[model samples]
Target: MSSRLALPPWLRVAAAMFAVGWGANQFAAMLLVYRDEDGFSSEAVTGLFGAYALGLIPALLVFGPISDRVGRRRVMRPVLVLSIAATVVLVVGGHSLAVLLVGRLMAGVASGAAFAPGSAWIKELSADRPGGTGARRAALALSAGFGSGPLVAGAVAQWLPAPTLLPYVPHLVLMALVVPIAWHAPEPAAPAADTSRHGHEVWRVLRGRPFVLGILLTAPWVFGAASTSFATIPTFVDVDVAPVAVTGALCGLTLWTGAFVQPFGKRLGDARLIIAAGLLAATCGLLLGVVVARTDLAWLLPLVAVLLGTAYGLVLVGGLTAIELMAHRDDLATLNAVFYSLTYIGFAAPLLSTLALRAVSPTALMAIGAAVALLTIPAALASRVSPRR
Candidate 1:
């Protein structure tokens, strides 16, 4: 008999819920515009984005492994409740920077809550299936959710009659739909027989060298790509074009290229090779951005967009693959949390880089940004290190 079962209705529901919850990050991008239009300084804009990550730290540290011990479904329902409240806060209190920060923080906590359990849930759902099926599903779900978030937010902002209000209105609708499904999602397995206290699970996992290296390697790849997609290019688009369309296009293209191109990039087979391809793609894209800055070439925008988007997509897929191959199963969620924590820290650099652009040109920023993306190559290498027999 086949060890596999159907995709399982509950898993599908959970994946969808995870995607919707994760989508909040895309909406936070809108805060960048709100900050500038409201005449807030760069530091203020940085604070706005930073709240999302701050919310994640505690959740990732506390909630992630707890779900591993408790059932994932149990943890998800409350997160949705929190997400709905955050969306409501954004809709009502968007004018104030402090309110925006709180909203972003709540959104981040939702994301942190969703990621590990969602990933693990997808894996468990596919455990009886053929080779690596769960990973693929998880990857597709994450990419789709992530890619859709910005598109949804951006499209509403661009075409809707009421830009600000419409963007999150759909999110409220999604929240309503997801919460019930989450409540009903099936748990395939009982908690592990060894239901020990999770008190020091984080430190236990962090002590592993491979886990630590994987976390460090992840920073450059995740942060570099995230910073570009979320902060740097958004700043550029806001400067050079109609704020809504340009921001929408940049994020939409970045996400679409990254996701849609994964099938082709995956054919390369070796995870390391895929990571290399992503690094090279981002390097070339960054270089193109620098040249466009130098030549003042408006036409080159599309080319740079495709390059970075594909690069980011490849890096994301590659990072997950590498981490899975490198870490022990028990360490998986903890290691991922550590990696993401560092990755969020790296996310902050672009905002700071944006501030630096006050003294320097965008060309200079592109040069520095591109260089930062390239540094991931070495981190990727380090993560791939194999112990000698």
Candidate 2:
């Protein structure tokens, strides 16, 4: 039966990435459920969302190196269980912000462990394929999980008993199916970095102009643009009818749009160009967000979502593709880790913007985000990214 259950190597690793991705977002739309029940402020709810980053960043910093040393399967198999446990924590969190915060933190840890290593694992497993296939597969799987998680969670939370608890059940069941297959997935060789040849390679790459200007400059907007599209933009509109489900749909719209855009981005051929185009799109989208926020327009939310989602999808794959060109085999996971950590910085955008609402208008804040995105374009273009073949 175990033999019968084994999935194709790359597919299984992709599945693990997907499952963790699903776990990472299952609670996103549930913010509405909590806020509605407890009368929590938007600030409090977004803070709960940001708590995931506190755990994720440290785990991301640690796990990539750990996986490079230990082999992908060793790290990934266990973390899937960790993800399940995190979901269990959320399942019973009910109305307690403290309990929900802990659950989110745990989910972040589980996600940070999987993301870089899983990206590297799937890339390694797809060595025989075209260069962009690995990155596209990774992006597609993660985005699919990201989009669907909220959609399902939102739907169940909107209509079901125990909204928070039941919303998490799908991910738990998903992991039970995924973990075994991932456990049996073939292991890639442990990527051992010899210090003599590549002394402190991650730092060395970090210092390179391309890495700094190309990736770091461009990465933050990846999620900055994304989080604002679904989380912040929707807050500007009042959805009295099935608001939670509507929030879920916004997440799905944003992420699924991004997932579908990867292939077109890949075809654009030059990773740097894609990154630049992405930043430009984000800038435009942010500017549009300013309009949406001021006009109190609900119909335009989908437009902003589509535009920002395009930015997220493009930069994400472009960054990964750029890393593929930049990093050595041994440092792939480490660089991936760095890239992901930077991307999560943007995840804080909604929270920051929510807090900023105290000092400035939402229109002004979104315009500021647009300005930042516009400034990033030159940095991305000036980046000495080796053109993807």
Candidate 3:
């Protein structure tokens, strides 16, 4: 590998963002292990899954504006440290449910603190790059990290020894090295101005029809559909059709597709159209999820991944692009944070799916989700009519 010093500032920041995202989703594959080994109930596992959002949302609301006031580096450095701490907590605590909860909360805080600032830093560092390139790079880094975490964890947990301990060890090592690299990454000379506004300002911006509707129609479904496709659907599949390793790979496939497709979203040249198309893809994919679950055609999981991944890519990039166009430079981080905060709602999909299963069959639940996705199309289409700020 090349020396850390030789890597560009944008790459370093991207690496840090990648680490944050990886940490956020690393536990997805581990949920099954906990259930089997520790005798955890399905509800307990669901709680653990949702715990990341518990820590992430508040952190984003608070740290985003702080990063806007202070430079990005100052905010990112401590969050990177917190990320390392979270991994250590996970490694040391082993299968203890309380410890895992705390570790996940810390992981959420680190991700929330890092993502918006790190993304804003990438944009500033790549100031000379073409339009939407920075956002594309940021999304790719995050998707790769998020997708790979579960894949690596599942593979190691299944084939390798020390299921819990070993999976996090590599992340610990990577984060430790990334700390210094992230510390050295360059910051913009001047931070954004008007950083002292109250929370009302953020709310005021959210009131905009374009920003609110764009997020409403796209952001939550991106991860919600992903959770359905990757996390929930795999668990229910027959072991013969979807082995443990194969499940992880499918999760990775979904995310990697999202990461790779983002650049083409830039090429598509219309954020509104991308959002509309993404919602349509998601609707079809959710309906297919019902079919995949009912028919036991695990072979079709890849097709499901493609649909969900394409939705993830187009909606995420298009939504971010729309938000960027509407936000003031001074409020960019806060706006990004706000957008992401809503996005985290999708992370609750696994938990919600679990509960919904009590009342309705998986097929019925997926059909309902597909209907919800379909209903959002009008909002996505409406986004085009509003002029970009």
Best by TM-score: 2
lDDT of 3 at 245: 68
Better candidate number, 2 or 3, judged by TM-score: 2
Candidate 1 deviation (Cα RMSD):
4.2
Better of 1 and 3 by TM-score: 3
Which one wins by TM-score: 1 or 2? 2
Please give the range of 10 consecutive residues that has the lowest summed lDDT in model 1: 1-10
Per-residue alpha-carbon lDDT of candidate 1 for residues 1-389, written as tens digits (9 for 90 to 100): 11113446536545554455445556644654565557777677766766677887778666766776676777777776787888888787657877877888888888777766666666666667743345455555666666666667866776666665677887777766556555566667554534353435546545655444544554455445644654565455324555565665666676667777676656865566667788778888888878776776656666776787777667666655555555444445555555556656755666677678889998887887678667766655565434211
- What value does the lDDT take at residue 239 in candidate 2? 79
Between candidates 1 and 2, the one scoring higher on lDDT is: 2
lDDT of 3 by residue, 244-330 (tens): 567678788888888888888877787888788888889999888899879988777888988998888788888777766666666
> Which portions of model 3 miss their true places by more than 4 Å?
195-201, 385-389
| Alpha-carbon shift of residue 153 in model 3 (angstroms) | 1.1
Tens digits of lDDT, candidate 2, 1-389: 55525556888889989889999987788888888888888888999988898999899989997887778888887799899999988877777889989999999999999999999999999888988788889888888888889989999999998876788889988988887778778875644567565446667788888999999888988888888888888888777888999899889888889899989997788888999888888988889888888889888988998999999999999999888888777777888999999999988988998888899988888888888888888888898866322
RMSD of 2: 1.8
Question: What is the lDDT of every predicted structure here?
Answer: 0.64, 0.86, 0.81
